[model samples]
Target: MTYYLGIDGGGTKTYALLTDDCGNVLGKGVGGNGNHQIDHALAAQSIRKAAEGALNEAGLRIHEISHTFFGLAGADREADYRILHPLVQDIGFTRNYSIDCDTMIGLRAGTNRPYGVALICGTGTNAAGRNPAGQHVQVGGFNYMYGDFGGGGSLNIEVFRSVIRSWDGREQTTLLTPLLLNFLGYDSVRDMFDDFQDHGKHVPVHAAKLLFEAAAEDDAVALEILNRQGVELGKSASAVIHKLGMEEDRFDVVLAGSLLTRGDRGWIRNMVEQTVAAVAPNAAIVTLATEPVVGALWSAMDADGHAVSQDVYDKMRVFRNFEHIKHQQDKRL
Candidate 1:
């Protein structure tokens, strides 16, 4: 009769799942942006809203939940914990709850093995790893400024960089300039730049999809961009694998985030696989097919010395369209 709560607090939307001791998900809820870096107070409200919805649907109260686990964006560093701990406490968990960066849950979500590497390349890039010894490590930046690569944000920035470079004659002409112009319905680059400047708008993250289109047309520039992205992703994963001394270990390389999950093993994913193979030949690549909150819940179960089965994972399929949620929900208005 004991119930557990698991939350995935992300930049786009927050998801909460409620389940019993047996790992059968009873209820799930969706809420707003839960990245505390955007606005901690508001983000806390989002988490609370999601948790409440899940609890309500299950006809259970917070008091009845035995444990709560939060895998949250912006829970990256000690400073983040200082800010997030108070917020999580404010959301009604006075004690007996656990918190970690969302990447940890993504790692657990992708594989049944307890130890492996995780490479995330969706809106942003992050790398993490765990070993059989229970040791864990996270490498690279939480944002592009930290030299992170291979995510939609960095890819979007690169596309514009190529456009500006080609326009100024610093680089050869690229399809990105014309493709972006047509995509945005602009006649010229000047108009596109002007419109963005006037509105203080940057390229949207989803625009990264253009790389695939350009590559499909055999655009050299786009192909190069994607290839480099894949290599960088592999290098990041390699670093974590070495740090965890897992290079010789046979483990799963969990690929999550929109960039790798979508498409048919595009340039980036292929290059990543090649690079990881050079470093960790024993590693097998796999995509995360479930919502990451499943990992948050499974991690809690693991902590309590319970073995998670494939049947549990099969119940954790993403219930909603993730890309659609990222694009349409939790606008920062």
Candidate 2:
């Protein structure tokens, strides 16, 4: 009875899944922030805690795992790899393990095909694509100063700026100002600004949801922000497609991340889809309906020379759905 481990480490949370060679999920665990850029010790702790929890739930020891795949955020450059590789190696407890950026697992999660693109827009944004010749193209993983845009962080920043502008009378009056004040429990934008400057207080990521709520009410400012983000996401996806030379090829473009998956707010997903379709007409846009840890599991099985059939993929999907339902039910208790 061989077990495989798969981990998806993100800015907000770390998720670990333990499964058998045949794709039967045994256990899953989640932990805190895993973004290495934020804090190395915190990231390592999150990864280890999540993995250990999953292993324990599976009634197995870490050393019993045959292989592991870690799909981690902030693993783009050599420096990132330098910091994360050893951490993974130290905590993995397995000799056979691989570390890759989150986008790789996202690509695999969309389709079994060897060539496709993945665009992740969550707390941050990144794009990666692979061509049939095994060549890869990546774009826009760097933070805001490096020309990256379209994510929860970016959206939050934009909303904050808009509120400030409205307060200063530099921009048209926006509901964001009052909504932000209410959300942050501040009496005025000046109070919010003072707290931010004095205490390092900042807009929370959940504030992005407020933008959607405002958009639902047809607030012009919120709609504009959502539309802008949608365009940016689409353009990023297009850039990856062109760089990978997949424009003419029919390939899967996996859209993963909370921003895109969040309940069709302001038709942001529709805007993204329309823009991408204009550029890559043959590309299929896919929203990741299951956890990306399943993709990491699939990658581990593939690397270990196991045949991952469609039936296996279907079973994983079903298991994920069941787990989601059970989790929801547990919350009620």
Candidate 3:
């Protein structure tokens, strides 16, 4: 049986998986940050370590693998490929290799039919969809300053502004102020201002969990934020569904990312479900049920075709224990 490898490279962590033709996982590996935004050396080091570690665990040498599929954040540009190519080529494992943005993998992962829409709302946001007709559409995903609504950065921005407005008395103070202070390690709001100046760091966008918590507690301001985020994401999804002309049966929405996939709040999911149902009653929203490594493998094998075998599909599903990872505070996790 042929050996295949898939790599999911993220901003904070990298994942590697090795499998045989039957889809049984042979080995798993973990590595540091592989995001393109980081320095090329650092990113390559992470990928190399992950690939080597996984191969070692699987009791195989690099050249023994037949194919490798890498889905990563930095492959959005030609320049990015230039930066990543040498590292991958140097590995000398799979002569058959493919690279794509993370969303491409997600789009392919959650579907048995091989075509559907995938939208992510983690540290960032982006949407992509491919129809049976082979045409495609994408929305947002530009960058944080430009768009990325419903993403971690967007949530952080909202919380920061809410605290500012509350302090200025322009908006009513809610439970969010104390929550923010506690998360930021500030004794008080005034102390937070000083700390912000000192670090000048981007607030933990993932801390939007606090807003979700507040909404669960029925804080009006937090609820409004989540509602607005839902509307924006709904609009993004609508654009993809319409472009694909999938108004007949319920088209799949592969919801990936921290904000949309969590079971705790249910506020964002509820808001999106309500708005999307109003616009397109046939839409079916579900989490991306497979790990992206499976998608990467599919991309490598089927890039030249439109269909995948049930054997391959079934094998991929074996690794998709999709509920193992939950959203929690970084320090807590």
Which candidate's TM-score is highest? 2
Give the alpha carbon lDDT tens digit for every residue of 58-175 in model 3.
9997677777888886666677778777768876644677887777787777776657778777666777787878887777775756666657766887887798789879999788
What is the Cα-based lDDT of residue 211 in candidate 1?
A: 86
Between candidates 1 and 2, the lDDT winner: 2
Give the Cα error of residue 153 in candidate 2, in Å. 2.0
> What are the RMSDs of all candidates, in order?
2.9, 2.8, 3.6
What is the TM-score ranking, best to worst? 2, 1, 3
From the highest lDDT down, the ranking of the candidates is 2, 1, 3
In order, candidate lDDTs are: 0.81, 0.81, 0.73
- Of 1 and 3, the candidate ahead on lDDT is 1
Model 3, residue 320: C-alpha shift (Å): 5.3
lDDT of 3 at 79: 78
TM-score of each: 0.88, 0.92, 0.85
Q: Pick the lDDT winner.
A: 2
As a whole number from 0 to 100, the lDDT of residue 100 in candidate 1 is 89
Measured on C-alpha atoms, candidate 2 has an lDDT of 0.81
Worst 10 residues of 2 by lDDT: 317-326
